[model samples]
Target chain A: MSSSSSSSSSTELSIPLHVKYIQSLGENKDDLIYHMTSHLRLNAIYWGLTALCVMNRQDALDREEMIAFVMSCWDEEAGGFGAHSGHDAHIHATLSAIQILILQDASDKIDVPRVVNCEPSKHIFHSRRTLPEMLTEGLPLLVILSLQQPSGVFAGDAFGEIDTRFSYIAVQSLSLLGQLDKLNVDKTVSYVLKCRNFDGGFGAVVGAESHAAMVFVCVALLAILDKLDEIDQETLAWWLAERQLPNGGLNGRPQKLEDVCYSFWVLSAMSILGKLTWIDADKLIQFILSAQDPENGGIADRPGDQPDVFHTLFGVAGLSLLGYPGLETIDPAYCLPESVTKRLGLRKNWKALPKRT
Target chain B: MPRVTSNNSDDEAQLYCEKSEWQDITPIPQYDGINPIAPIFYTPEYKDATEYFRAIVKADEVSERVLQLTYDIISMNPAHYSAWQYRYRTLVALKHPLDVELELMDAFAIKFLKTYQVWHHRRLLLTALRSSAPSPLSIASKELAFIIRALSTDTKNYHTWSYRQWLLAFFDDEELWEGELPYVERLLETDVRNNSAWHHRYFVVWGRVRAEGEIDVGDVLKREIAYTKDQIALAPNNPSAWNYLRGILEHTKTPFNSLRTFVELYSTQTAPGEEDIVDLDNPKPGPGAQLPCAPALEFLADIHEEMGGEQTKKAIEIWKSLGNEYDTMRKKYWEFRVKEALSV
Candidate 1:
């Protein structure tokens, strides 16, 4: 409970995990996979980071080993990804793999057309599609392929239901690649809008409970679509602000304990919308720094735990998004490594295209 | 039940066992002397390094003394689940007691439930506990209860719920366990926006059913959905109740009753995610412009048919309030009639 004093700024050293394990989960056949502990949404986040790690400049050999471990759990026949190999083909894993592949720069390795809005077989969207088109073309196609049906929302596997949160993932995956146009944007938008609950943030889908994590996806999707103006700014921001506890970490849900990861999800969206000012930046950064591996130079998902590559990347990403010193200012719309984005000279403002002919 | 893994060693199992009880152990006299204690293994010189081989790497062991020192160093943090985890993570197939240790491995598991090490440790602990001599049921049950108690403190505790579900399945008897389904329902009553409780409730239903063996899932889910509606009726502004209801209603085999409840509950949630301007030009508008009340109008139209009566009219009002722009809201404007048929 002790606070960081002026004397401790230089004295504090933070270390998130240095490696991430982005393993392969699905294919037309089985491959290497890592069994997720449980909870699909979280498992997906880990896989997402693993995929991101394959591209990290600082990722160590253990990162590759971690990815290999996750890949070992893949169910080759499902033609998609899962938290672990042999587990169901959840959209969470599928989208995670796609992003990781994008990070790996192995986007070509994936049969893109077949996955994005390509019914039964189309993976590649024509080059003419807007950044939204190209993005929506590939990822949501996989989401469509994976949909359980009648719901129009995405299912984790073919057999799973069209759960709410993933609609955010499915849509965000498209947004990440700049392809919101490939799918029926109206339908996707409406579906996501319905998932909004009394709490003023988006949930997994219609009538689902609003959660801080899903709020991230919901706001992120809208932000990517150039539709930030659509959300209930006051209500959503209140919810986001309330997520910060007396201790300064963000929790995904109420009465729930806080985690370092939520700081990224909840605050990043707030940062994008200009609502993070209420959060104690100094305290949040301190909480994040405390979660670092005192032994190694990375972070654990929470303090007093072992460091993993996923949390390490995100913890740093969260701090970077917070405009922590030395770290580059993060671009939320595009989750590009701030350092890389800064080097590439990207702007903080997320831009949208004009009317499509 | 051990899956393919990188850990397969007696030393790994031994360290996991010792880590479970280090919480009550004596503190190192030197721990207070240093701001952070480095691994004692790194400082001590090894005598016999040949025994440290992990088998997969085909390298000689770092030395038994080094291994013991590392094990002891890792054991210092009773809650360092991954330290205990990585110690056994060499081949990924290490023999370990998963449930017992996982029950004891609360801090790390609770804070970082999604980590590979926490999970692998739990899985190893469970697998080992199941195979342990005489089986520590009392120990296992006590830990499960602790998880449940911790979950009660925070319903959205995914890690606690996940691990608790794993244990309930092994323990069996929904009738015997009374499962926490009713408690979840009660919590929902108190706070319609309680997502963690609702999430935990979903797993509770799943766990109870596995224990009970074929209770009416649809009827039960319907009851659960009603619980959300009750929340909505009380706090129309609460989005969590609607989200919880939506989670229950969206899936097929989702009882019509639950579907009914979602439509019933969604009345207040219609304009969610909005706190500023509402442009009449685009009733659906853009993100953050206004609450998403208009976009759900059509979906509500469909959902209300299942709900019947005033619920349907309420759905129409929600739709009409979005402003009188046009016949449809689509990018390419798929003929709704044709698209509906094709989509079906």
Candidate 2:
């Protein structure tokens, strides 16, 4: 193993290193960190796979194996994917699972009909449903719709914890499943509009401070629902553009530290708003590249930090949005490969940076 | 099902068993070029924690042992959401007192004030108690006090603010609604620039119109306008106050030009014919220590943009100065505004 290097001169993304880094994550089953992060295992796989896809190395990870693992995370009772096999179903993991399947072109493997209608009564006597069948219930869309609170914001689950993030996840998940007609679009859009602060950015919930991540979710949700005009675009774009610091890294909120993840959050919003030029792309690309673990295969929150799959995916995804050379273009609205989103006819009007030759 | 061993010393056995079972899976290629594992992943303590968590999950046991295991995990890493989930499940299964769970969460809340799971767990407990509690309003009031304490420690804590908003939704009490503005006033008195406090203020004032169904919005707007003006006078550069001021004005449909007193107090001017020039360097500010702060200029520009002809020309001038002088970081944005104003 090589030593961690802190050189900023290496502006190139170490795609091969990152590919290996992601590959190495699943190699050590005995590692305590692996078990510790089991809850995020499915999300991690999506991050890793998406990062690989952005790097033009989508096949680096074994597809069959990856699909098997994602299917394993089915929470049978809730009709949604859980973070891990034993974890309860949540909207987040379910979205990640669906995205992963779409990326792998294995979406057809999902038994939507069985999963959607699989009732507890049906399962009680049969005991014959496969693990995937038990978990991949068509109920996810219904479950997601059910989580919509009276205020129009969605709960992450039956726990009734409402957040704009959940709204975005629900919107995207339903749209992907062609179930947008089932959603209360007017109510969802109204709640999102209420979360808008005077700064033109959105918060996780109403009355919360505006954050770049929350802005992305709200904006993306609006775009999906075709209600982008409901917000003050110019003011929001100004707030988003201001997220960039001198170092070219973006922060979630005012007075927060710059992080690599905001590259996706901030840039995606800018992309959707047709304000991609507002950002200093070259400097941001350099910042994202600098956060790469030159020795490891993943990117970190910042330089000198340990690399993780979450930041790695976002960094690469941001780079893709920035029109980095040889990388796949990402749909800023969905955080998926442009090709995949387009193929599914779920693409919106957002623009990515023109890919450099 | 695996026989769950409670011995902490058997961590290695737990790891070995899990590893052996997965041995048949094809190992991923390790790029020889990659770096060694970070030191953070190699600690014995981390290994033990993970092993204990694995054993608990494998056992699928919702016992006191699992509760302790989850608590141990959570103490070290409050952001570990799965551990919190397990703990919540265990608490519910064991029928642990909601108050006890709340008390246990207090230490975690203080230690990891920003952690989402801790705040979420607190919300779950409070929500669970809402239906059965003899006095739900009192419980909500108490939670509000707890949240206020949390906010006092880190005035801008997002999770705390969100939780506070969540808790407030349960109460329809006029007294509770009445208390909110003063509570915000107290917070803003401590820190005039606390944006969260300002946001809470907005929620209280505007939210009342929706919640109560009969509020004298005109009166509230007048009071809020005065409050924001006072806040701005205290700190002209405070964006929170400016935002609050703008929100109140917009909600009330009070035209920017209609704020005659405010405009006279804060308006800045550029030299004749110089307004058209896009000065990239050494832009001039309006004369004086008090007038033409960025927000004031921007607000005036908005009003002028809404009005046409002569006012549009004046708005362009203000935009030019704002781009170059007061809000230089957003010079390009201000320039865009100028262009937009000129086009109008």
Candidate 3:
């Protein structure tokens, strides 16, 4: 397990060790880092669980306990889950909760009617009774639509801070809830289109510089809305391919240091564009493997940085997109496993690298 | 519970916590430190902070004491957004002066320039002060100066730039808009590669364009194009300038032929060379000549395609050289461009 030995060999993903690392994340409740990260607890759980699923070790963590934690984070007032119990509900945590539930095949546990009716003014007037009935009424759709600003971007919540990230979150969340048709699709697309910079890459907001993470969110948003044709794909793909650095890692923007998370952001966008081959996959694989904590069983942002759940999930997801052996194929558009997305009939026309032998 | 006895044998150290709480948590055994049972597994500082935070949460108090506690927590971990939230609630509940809170945030900004919570807290304080401040525009001017100092340190700090934009939009003063261009010009003069400055320039100029209905956008585009050309002349390989040039062209809907003429003239002045055919497969020319004016070459290819026929064929040859020799890393992209041009 020495770094030198691991580096000498064709660095393969240590699935068992990574699984153990992810499983150990929730063990030390008394640890300050654990409590300090309470605000990101649900998101961390999603990252860990998704990484495990990509590693084909979905059972590494106890499913029942995980589900209970997600449910505990439900904010009764907001009718959505918060980052942690007693935290205010946010669109981000709500999406993570929904994603975790869907992946666990436990979407049934969600009190859909209760969530939909959390704001009675939107739903009660619709005269719908059951969850499906309310959905068709488009009451929940109004709840999400209300967060959109006049600029076509979305705020994370009623607090009114906006980012293109929230735009994608709204799109994905609404799509998952079967309310995509109710969204002002043209308005949403226009907002995203406004975020596009001269480099043909999307930014966090209008007039912002192109960033890899924002590119993924915008591209995925467009893909979900069936507006992929609106973007200058060749220019964007070129900008994305240029993210790959000499060491085979991807940076978020030009003149930036390469990070492991960009592996997912850049690779996912490329996958969606059917241009994954534009990057040197072998070098990227080696770089990702090098970022692994050989002894600690998690991936870091870079080769020597401390490992975190965020990087670990992104590293594995990138590998999944790269068609690494023995890993579940992750839907680049959704960041969910292909099987789960397929089951939900949410898979879009995106490509992942062919699985290696 | 497992207890460890000191060498003095007179004192016994209690187990950090009951084992059941951390049943499956593997303790790091390498370090011999305080709280040996939890050594390497958890830092003592974090445990103390959490306990303090929990006590505050439990008490549900909004007092000077709570503010101090939250400050200590934030000082230890600025990324603790919950700590900032608690501090904000306590400050509001205690009727703390918005200006005082803003001043405190300025201090925190110096220490934690890149922390999102710090910038967000500043935004909240500024929003609260908007109505009460004697002259809100003056306060915005002060805030703008403060942000400029920050951008001077780290030109590409997105949070700082975003906050600056938020502040400008918050004021929405016509006078403030006039000052933005010169401010951005000062920044760009210092470093032409600062994309944040370039973006801010575009934002302010576009805002002015939108505000003044009669302003000639064609004139503005020409001026911006000239400015970008000057910047590109200073550092031809700088992507920010190149992108800025393209942004103006796209915004103005100016013909590619105009850009082509501009670039062709500029390139010859910068790096004179014959229009000799370059081998697409071979990496022709040395490094110095390859990238001195890449954006110019790229634009040339675009113009050639638009012109069609012989120009399209010539454009393919230039793209090959640019792809293979100048921007080798983006060879596939350039090749794709070549293919696209051929089809056209």
Candidate 4:
């Protein structure tokens, strides 16, 4: 990573302050924003935990308390997890629950089936239906697989709102649970291919405009499925590289404002494609650092914006992929700490820049 | 979804927990006090509403009262998917007029444009309306009009654009696709740099490549290439137009050199003079256009590289200039491109 930029003078990650900020997030019980954000509660926890992990302060947030929160969000009736307690189960929240469990070395908390025992149902299924033999074990795996439509795209919930994002979540969750063999890889990959735009970037759904966040999900899911050969790598890389603006921040789509979150969305996809070297690391590091709230910690979408956990996690994850100093390496394909993915033996072919000293 | 604060005194004064009709239901707290983990301190108002919501779900009550309760929950937190799902089920069970429900959603959709549940609820209503309504086409048209109004507020909202795309494809009517191109054109005209509008253009034109009674593919290609050039002239640095230009060429398997002259028009840093003669075949950048546009330079380089032999040197120079000067943010990408080409 290049260090020859004027950004080196006034910008530092302020990891200590950021760690404090994350630790304090759950302490305020009376904040109205807290109640309003119950729908994103589980996902927010994952982001905070992952950001803390990336900064190499995994223990800053009590592991026992964090794991308990994740388990509390489990929706036993739906065979999956929800965003918060008393909320219905959703695929997005289920993935976050699994991610947090793995990050905290609590993967064993989720009991898995010894073998795939989903018997084909006699009744006609809209898609290929697999009746779960044992619901107690591998319930999330069942919930996820049940959501895939005949078109191969997974729905966020029973409401049937399909997107490439859910496809990625399903793939990632199944892979983490060691149940990827149950997924129809070909069908899932074909759906992702359908979402690809002329610019070589992926979108939320077929016929929608390409966005960097969707690109990351599609690319990472493809990598997990070992179907990297399917994409137009060079074309997509060029599109991803072009997302970097003159200010050194990346945007999710063309002509959009530069946001810190796209730093991870664009960079993670590029890293999975082995095109991480294409970005100007020095300038991007400067941009990500500039978004940091030096006094209170946490990174924002842009400089001077109120910092939030979503952008904060993305910012730290982007910095980790950029080889920022004294940070844990994040797995580009999974968004988990490299150590976690490596230990799980689920790491895919991805390349992050060399860690800067 | 961020909290949508209401200034109405009525909204502030109302509390379901205090009402006599809601007295029979016991509120269910999100977490029991036994070692609650990262518990959200919900407001007394939200707490009351959600507690009653839990009671209704447990009781399996799909009634008019449940509708009002779900609405109160949703108004406070638009992303409560459970509330949305329950509300839809209630609407269906009560045999309520979905059009009236849709009318209620119109303002809510605009108020919470980015919320996924809001759009999804609209999708469910439209899907239901289509199957039962006498004229599905009328429903489709009105929904399209509503989407246009939603797009006016936030032109690039992902949910709005994708929902619009879903609506067209769902209807699969010739009339729906017919008006799509002109609608996209107006959006592009308003903001030439709108990628969503440009993507919709691709969806409309190329999506009809071999449809029955459509225009010739060859004619469509020529018209699109010219249309893209005109857009590029308006804003030289706009990557969306350039990407569309490349998309058209690559999708049709047309050679990059086909537009070499047009590509060269914006390759140089010089702006056109007021008296400069206009060329219909090659559009010149407007006075406001930022010259030495990186995409145009890259296109020129690709054209030269396609020619092979001595022309490859010209491609190398352009690539070097892009890295060293024009687009320094992606300097490393240009360097890598040159290295990859040389190695091959």
**Winning model by TM-score:** 4
Candidate 2 on B198-225: residue-level lDDT in tens? 8788777775447354767788777777
Among all windows of ten consecutive residues in candidate 4 chain A, which has the lowest summed lDDT? Answer: A114-123
lDDT of 2 by residue, A62-167 (tens): 8877776676666656668887654568889999998998898876664322221123454422343443353344577768898899989998875556799999
**lDDT (C-alpha) at residue A125 in model 3:** 36
- Over the stretch B170-252, how does candidate 3's per-residue lDDT look in tens digits? 77788777889988888889887777788788778764335456687877886777777666656666777777777777777
What's model 2's TM-score?
0.78
User: What is the DockQ (computed on Cα atoms) for candidate 2?
Assistant: 0.16
CAPRI class of candidate 4: medium
- lDDT string for model 1 (A35-125, tens) is 1223243354444453243234334333443334334333233545654432335567656655554444444333322121212243233
Best by lDDT: 4
Better by DockQ, candidate 2 or 1? 2
Q: Candidate 2: count the clashes.
A: 7
Question: What local lDDT score does residue A335 receive in model 3, on the 0 to 100 scale?
Answer: 91
Model 3 chain A scores worst on lDDT over the 10 consecutive residues at A111-120
Per-model TM-score of chain A alone? 0.68, 0.91, 0.91, 0.90
lDDT digits (tens) for residues A1-357 of candidate 3 = 435455543387888889999989888876768866776888998999999999889998888777766765655445566776545567788789878988888765543322221233443433314334444655445656888999889977655668899999999989888778778888899989988877788878766778899999999999888889998987889789878887889999876889999999999999999888777788899999899988878999999889999999999999989888899999988899999989989999999999996
Q: Which residue runs does candidate 2 get wrong by more than 4 Å?
A: A1-10, A28-33, A109-139, A295-297, B1-97, B128-131, B210-223, B258-293, B322-332
Pitting candidate 1 against candidate 2, the one with the higher TM-score is 2
Interface RMSD of each: 17.9, 9.4, 9.5, 5.4
Q: In model 1, which regions exceed 4 Å deviation?
A: A1-78, A81-89, A108-149, A176-179, A338-357, B1-344
Better of 2 and 4 by lDDT: 4
Shift in Å, residue A138, candidate 4: 2.5
